[model samples]
Target: MRLERTRREPEAGMAVRTQLPAPPAWMRWLPALFVAALLLVEPFTPVDWPVSFALITVPLLAAFTQGPLGVAAVTVFAVLFEGVLAGTPCCAGRSVGYLWERHYVASYVCTILVGAIGTVLAAHRTRRERTLADVRFVAEIAQRVLLRPVPHRIGNLLLESLYLSAAAEARIGGDLYEAVPTSYGVRLLIGDVRGKGLLAVETAATLLGAFREAAHDEPDLPSLADRVEVSMGRRAMLLGGGEVGERFVTAVFAEIPTEGHLVRIVNCGHPPPLLIRSDEVSELDRGRSAPPLNLGVLVGEPYSVDVYDFRPGDQLLLYTDGITETRDPHGVFYPLLERLRSWGPLPPRELLEQLHGDLMAYSHNGLQDDIAALTACLLADQPAEPAPPSDGAGGSSGAP
Candidate 1:
C-alpha cells in the first residue's frame, strides 16, 4: 500500500554554497594587465635582465583559474608583445627579422612550450571536476530515496532528525529511520545495520521497505515486527551469499496512539529511547529486549512491546549506537544523559541542533560510525497547527 499525504523536504540538486565571495571584476583581467606592464618595462630594464621571462607568469596563472581558451589568448598576447619588442628601435634596436636572433629565438620557443603544457593541464583539471559533480548527483538521489526527510510535524507530534556519516567522502551510510502515520497510530522505526559499505546500505534499504509496507497493515507492534523480520530473512538469503547467517539489524520500533498519552516500544537489541521532560531525562526501558531483527531464530521468546507514559510536553529520543559509543581522547564514552540535563526543554529542532554540535565537540569531530537521531515531542494542550503541504515527494504517511 502507498503512504498517504506525506510531506518531505525538497531536494536541492547540485547547489553548493561557498564561504568566500566571488573575486572582484578587476581580478579577471589582472594577468593580461601584468603581461602588458612587463612588455612596457622590457625597454627600460638593464640590458643583462630579460624582462620577457616575466611574461611566462600570465599563461601559468590563467591555466589554474580559466579554461584552455583563456590560456591560449594569453599565450597569443605574449607572442605579439615579443614581436613588437624585437622591431622597436627603443627596445631590441633591430628590425622584425631580429626574431631569428639566438637569444630572442630561445625566449620565444620557451614561452610557447610552457603555454602548451599549461593548456593540457587546464583541460585535465576541467574533466576531473565534471566527473566529481556527476558522482555527487548520484549520491544525493540515493540519499533522498533511502533516508527520506522526516516532516517537521506528524499528527500531534513535532519531529526533528539528524544524520551524520563518518565517511566524509560518502554522505550516506547504514543508519536509517522512518516515521509513518497509520490507521492504528503513528509508527516509527530507527535502525542500524550490522556493518558498513554497500552491503550494510542494502540491508538498511530492505528493512525500511518492509517496515513502511507492514506498518499500516499489521494490527499491533509485535505483528509488524514479525513481518519485518520475515522480510529481512528473505533479503538476507538473496543478498547475503553464505554470510546470510551473520546479517542483522539493531532497531527500535514504536507506536504512538492517535489520542493517548502512551507510547509503546519494542527494542530489538538497540539502545533504549530516552524520555525528556523539563530538567529531567530518563531511559524508557532497561528490563528486557529482543534479539536484533533477522536473528530471531536465536531468541526462542517472542518480542514484547514496552508501554511508557508519553505525556504532553515530554519528548521521546531515539538514536543509533553511534551517539552512546562515541569516545573521547581518554577513551571514555559520551555522557548523553548528563548533557541533556543542561539543554532545558528546548523544541525538537533546537534540541537536535544543540545535541549535534555538542556531540561533534565531545568527539573532537572524529566520529567513527554513522549517527542518526530522531526526536518526537507530544504537543501541549493547545491544538497542533495543521501540517504544511507536501512538496509532492510522497514521504511515508499514516492516519491521524
Candidate 2:
C-alpha cells in the first residue's frame, strides 16, 4: 500500500529588517573624547602654540560613525569651540580682543571646508552600507529557501546541520543539505558542487529538489541515488551548455531505518561519513568508490550502497571537503579525525557548535571554500528479535 504524502505548507516567520547595526558606543563617542582631550590640554601648551586648531579632526572622526547631519553638527560645534579657545584669557594667554583675528578666521573657514568634505563622505558611506545590507537581507532569504534549516528531530534520529560560505557576505553557496522523513526512513543528503557562483548554487538547488522528491517515491537507497544522478545530469546539461563535464556534485546519501539498528549510505565521490561510537571515531569508507553525480555518464560506474551499524547512542557526521581542506597559518590542514577523538561525547547540536568554533579558530576565521556538515545521532533502541513490520499482505514494511 502506498502512503499518501502530504504537502507541507511553506514556513512563515517575521521578516526581519537586517539593516546595519548602529556603531559601537565607544566609536560614537570618539569625536567627543577628542574635543574633550583638546580642551583639557590646551591650557598646558605654550602661549605661542594653540591646540584648538586640532578641533578640525573632530568632525572628520565623526564622519566614520555618524550620519551627515551629525557630522555637520560636530563641525559647527568645533568652529564655535575654536573661537572660545582663541578668546579665552586663562588658556594659552590669548586675549578676547583677538577672537576674530585673521589667522583665527582662516582656521574657521578651513574647518568648515573639511567639515563639508566629511559630510559628503558620511553620506556616501551611509548609502553604500544600506545597499550592502539590502543585498545581505536577500541572501539570507535565499539561504532559507535553498538550504532550509534541518529539523533537530527526524523520527528516532537527532540531526544538526551547519553551513558556511567562503565569501564573507554570502549566506548560501554550492554547499547544500536536506533531511526528509519518509516511509523508507529518515533520508539525508549533503553535497558540494564543483565550481562557485550562481551556476553552482543553481546546481545545488537542483540536486536538493531531486533528493527531496525521490527520497519518498524511490523505495530503495541505490534506486533513489540513481534518480538523483539522472536529475543532476539533465540539470548540468541544461546549465552547462557545452561544458557539462565541468558540472558535478560530490554527495553522500544516507537512510536510517525507522525501526532498525543499521544505516545505509551511498557516497558519490564525497568524503566518507565519520562514525563516533563510545569516544572512538572511524571513517565509513566504502571499499569501492563511485563517481560524482553527472559524471556517471562519463565514468560508467554503478552506485554502491554500504550498510553500517548505527545503533542507539551512535553519532554519524557527514561533511564536505571544505572542513578537511581548511588550512592554518602554518599551512597545515585541519585534523578533523584527530580533533574529534579528543572531545568527549556531546549531543549533535553541541558537537556541531564546538566544531564550528574550532574550525573558525583553526583557520583564523578565514575559509577558502564553502562548507556544509550534518550530524545524525540515533536516539531509539531496537526491539529484541526485531523484524520489519508487515504492511498488510504479511510482507515486510521496509523498502526493498
TM-score (C-alpha, index-matched) for candidate 2: 0.90
Candidate 1 structure quality by residue, lDDT tens digits, 82-103: 7666546566333234555688
Give model 1's TM-score versus the native structure: 0.77
**Which runs in model 1 stand beyond 4 Å of their true positions?**
1-61, 77-107, 327-333, 363-365, 383-400
Shift of residue 108 alpha carbon in model 1, Å: 3.8
Model 2 spans > 4 angstroms off: 1-11, 95-97, 382-400
Over 1-400, each residue of candidate 2 has an lDDT whose tens digit, in order, gives 0111111225565346577858889999999888889878988898777788888788899999999999999999999989988877888765543588888888999999999999999999899889978988897777778887788788778888887777867777898888999998999998989989988889999999999999999998879989999999887777757668879999999999887799999998899999998868999995765888888888777778899998889999999999999999998999999999999678998888888889889998888887888999998664689767767977666777
Shift of residue 392 alpha carbon in model 1, Å: 48
Backbone clashes in each candidate structure, one number apiece? 4, 0
| Candidate 2 residue pairs in backbone clash | none
Identify the candidate with maximal TM-score: 2
Q: Candidate 1: deviation at residue 277, Å?
A: 1.1
Residue 366 lDDT, candidate 2, scale 0-100: 81
**Whole-model alpha-carbon lDDT for candidate 2:** 0.85
